[model samples]
Each structure stands twice: as structure tokens, then as C-alpha cells.
Target: MSSMSARRGSRIGRGMAWAILIAAVLVTVFPFYWMVRTALTPAGDLFADSHALWPHHPTLINFKRVLGMTSAERARAAGGSGAQINFLWYTLNSIIYSAVIAIAQTFFCAMAGYAFARLRFPFRDALFGILVAALMVPPIFTLLPNFTMVKNLGLMNTFFGLVAPSVLMTPFAVFFLRQFFLSIPKEVEEAAVLDGVGRWGAFWRIIVPMSRGPLITIGLTTTVWAWKDYLWPLLVGRGEHTRVLTVALGVFLQQSPNTQPDWTGLMAGSTLSVLPVLVLLIFLGKRLVQSLNFSGIK
Candidate 1:
């Protein structure tokens, strides 16, 4: 009877967990659903609640507008080229920026984490503690200073300005990586050292290969954050020459003199922007979860 009761309880718990997950997914996905719904609706009655759940006359016009494909159509074609946005350029810039940050962030964080975890150095704990304290300070607090520094370096309106401060060495990356490195067994390194491998060599050859899980997690995380970054890019990249996708998307929506938003095109751009992350999450989900668990985030 007790065994049966336990089985029943386990089943109940699993069911409840799934119920909660479904609810959370619905909450998270509903906004995107609504955005697409709005995008599909005809421009004439976009604000009408009666048609809010579903469009009266669903059309691809909005996507066409966002992609500049609708410019030839009577609905939006009359708008001169002067009004069109250079979304493709900004998107490429975003891709380049995020990719660079991910690579640099992963390598730097892993090396720093190895130092903290294995290498004996003076003031290591003190320096790490300082890094931890730095995390508590919100990034927004440093924006003005960052901007000033960028200006002083004459990096404003340049990719270097955006990449230099953020991509190179962030405190959070160090912290997360350090936590992961802690979970690695010291015996492996000791064995490698006994086998005549030097410290740096052991880390490069032995340690890093075993820690692919954690590195990929950190890389994905850094990529996602770098891609989503808007404020920093907006501040440093004023002209179209340096604008990333996020700021360009904002500009796209607000371009109409009447402040009229383009629902379809906006959703299309957003969906496109989100595609890479979604694909990444799908591919990395297992590794990410395992890494997080191994890194001590129970």
C-alpha cells in the first residue's frame, strides 16, 4: 500500500510540474503570439479588440513593409527611399558584434576561471572577491562613464567602441566560469602534472576538453546577452553605420511621422531576430542544463 501510494504521489507531482510548465510557457509565448496576430491584421482596424484574437483579413502586408518588399505595393510603395531603413546592415553588424563577444568572452572567462581555480597567485582571492562585488553594481550605473571613456578613446560611432568595453572581460563571465571550474576534480590536473605536463599546458589540453559543457553554456549565454544589448549600442553607434539590430528594429517601428507602428514587419523582424537564439537554445538545451547543474546552480 505504501509503495502504491508513493507511486501515485510521484505521478501526481509529475503532472503538477507539467501543468506549471505549460502555464509558464503560455504566459511567455502569448505576447509573441499577440504580436504576430497584430502583424497579420489589416492596417485599417488593428486597434479593434473584437478582431484582436484573430485578424478579420489576415495579410502578409506588414511583413512586406518591414522587409521593404511592400514598397512596390500601392499600400506602402509611394513612400520614398528616404523613409526606408537599412535593417540588413544593422543586422549584419549585430551578428558580427555578438559573435566576436561570444568568442572573446568564452576564451577570456575560461582562462580567468582556470587561474582562479588552479593557479596559485598573489591576491587571487582578493581580486576575485573584487570581481564578485563588481557584479552587484548595475551596468547602467557605468554607462555614462563607459560612454565618456569611449568618447575619449575616439571610438564612438565605431564597432571597436562597442566591442572593447563589453566583449573583452566581463565580471559575470568570470564568476559563472569560476563556479563551473570549481566542480571539476583536482585529481585530473594532478595526474596531468605528474605526467610532466606544465600547468598552462594541462589546462589547455586536459582541463578544457573535459569542460566543453560549461564553456558552451557560457558562450551561449554571452552570445544571447550580447545580441540583446540595445542601450550600449544605441549610445555608441549613433549613425546607421554602426547601429545593431535592436536599435534598428526600434527605429523601424518609430519611422512613421504619425508614429504609426508597422505590426507585421515588426513581428517579422522580431521573429527573425529571435530565430538564432531559439535555434541555439534548442541545440544547447541539454548541455546548458547539465552545465548549470554541474556549476552548482541547483
Candidate 2:
């Protein structure tokens, strides 16, 4: 009788776990579903009293206007006068900004992390502690200083200004990579040394290859952060020439002349903006999971 009760309790616990997981999935996915649904629904039908879960009248009008494929009259009606900023160009800028930051952060952070893990030098721990401490500092606090530094360097409105401050490395990336590097066995490096492999060669050929998972994780994270960043880019990248997707989306939201926000176009633009990051995660997410599992990062 006791064994049967134990089995029944286990089944109930498993059922509750599955129920919780399904609820969590719904909570997470519903927003994306709503965004896409709104994007598909014609602007006229969106506010109708009898709104359907699926779009009643599916239309590409919102996407067409956002993508600049619609007639000039239609574009003007939907996006207003300030919609002159090209959506595709803004997307391109985001891609460039995110890609450069990701590559630079991954390489530099890996080098810094390896040094902290393996190299001996004066004030090494102290310096690393400072770097780690920076993780606790709110990014908002540094905005003024970074803006001043960028202005002093005469990099405003340039791609360099957008990329320079953040592209090099980040505190979190360094800390994360350092932790991963610490988990590596020193015997591997010693064996490489015994085989006459110099430190640089060993790092490049062995350590980097072995650390691919962590590197990918850092790169993906940096890329996503850079892509979503709006404040810094908006501050420095003032002109359409340097505008990124997030800033452009904000601009789009405000482009409505009469203060009536173009909900349909906004939803369409949002859906488009989210696609690149989603595709990136879909492709690289497995590597991230593998890295976390391999590194015992749970």
C-alpha cells in the first residue's frame, strides 16, 4: 500500500512539472504570436470588436510599407513624413555593429581570460578583481563618461563611435571566459610546452579549438546585446547614416504626425527586427547548451 502511494505521488509530481513547463512555454511564446498576428492583421481590422485569434483579414500591407515596397501615398499614409529613414539600411547598420562587436569581444575577452587563467604578472588578481567589480556597475553610470570620451576623440556620428567603446570587450565576457578557462587542465598546456609548442601556438591551436563552445557563447551574447542596444547608439549615432535597427524602430514609433501610433507598422517592424536574433539563436543555441553542459556551468 505504501509503495502504491509513493508511485501515485511521483506520477502527480511529474504531471505538475509538465503542466508548469507548458504554461511557461505559453507565457514565453504568446508575445511573439501576438506580434506576428498583429503584423498580419490589416490595420483596419485590428481594433474591430470581434477580433479573432487568427487574423480575420491577413494582409502584407504592414510589411510592404515597413519594407518600403508600397506606393508613396500608402507609405505616407502609414509612416508619415519621418519614414524617410530606410528600414533596410538600419538593419544593415545593426548587422555591422553587432558583428564587429561580437568578433572583437570574443577575441579580446578570450585573450584576457586566458591571461588571467594561465599567466603570472604583477597585480593580476587585483586587476581581474577590478574587471569583475565593473560587472556590478550600472551601465547608465558610464554613459556620460563614454559620450564625453567619444566626443573628445571626434568619433560622433561615425560607425567607429558606435563600435569603439563596446567592441573591445566586456566585464561579463571576460569573467565568463575566465571561469571557463580556469576549468581547463594545466596538463594540456604543459604537454604542449614539452612538445616545443610556444604559448601563442598552444593557445591558438589547442586552447582556442577546445574552447570553441565558450567562445561561441560569448560571441552570441555580445552580438545580441549589441543588436538590442538603443541608448548608446541613439546618443552617438545621431544621423540616418549611422542609425541601427533599434533606434530606427524607436524613430518609426514616433514618426506618426498626429500622435496616433501606427500599431500595425510597428508590429511589422518589430517582427522583422526580431528575426535575425531568432535565426542566430536557432542556429547557435545548441552550441551554447553543449558548452554549458560540457563546462558543468549548471
Clashes per model (N, Cα, C within 3 A):
2, 0
Give candidate 1's whole-model lDDT.
0.78
**lDDT to native, each model:** 0.78, 0.84
Best by the TM-score measure: 2
What does the lDDT come to for candidate 2? 0.84
Sliding window of 10 residues with minimal summed lDDT for model 1: 73-82
Task: Report RMSD (Å) for each prediction in the order shown.
Answer: 3.9, 2.7
Give the per-residue lDDT of model 1 (tens digit) for 143-254.
Answer: 8898999999899898889888877788978888788778788998998888888888899998899888778878877888899999998898967888888988878667
Model 2 lDDT tens row, 1-298: 9999999999999999999999999999999988998888877776781357888778888888877777778766654453564677888899999999999889999999999999889999999999999999899999899999999999999999989888888998888888888989999887897798878888898999999878888887788789889999999996889989899888887776565677778888899899997887798777756655534442
TM-score of each: 0.81, 0.88
Q: Number of clashing pairs, model 1?
A: 2
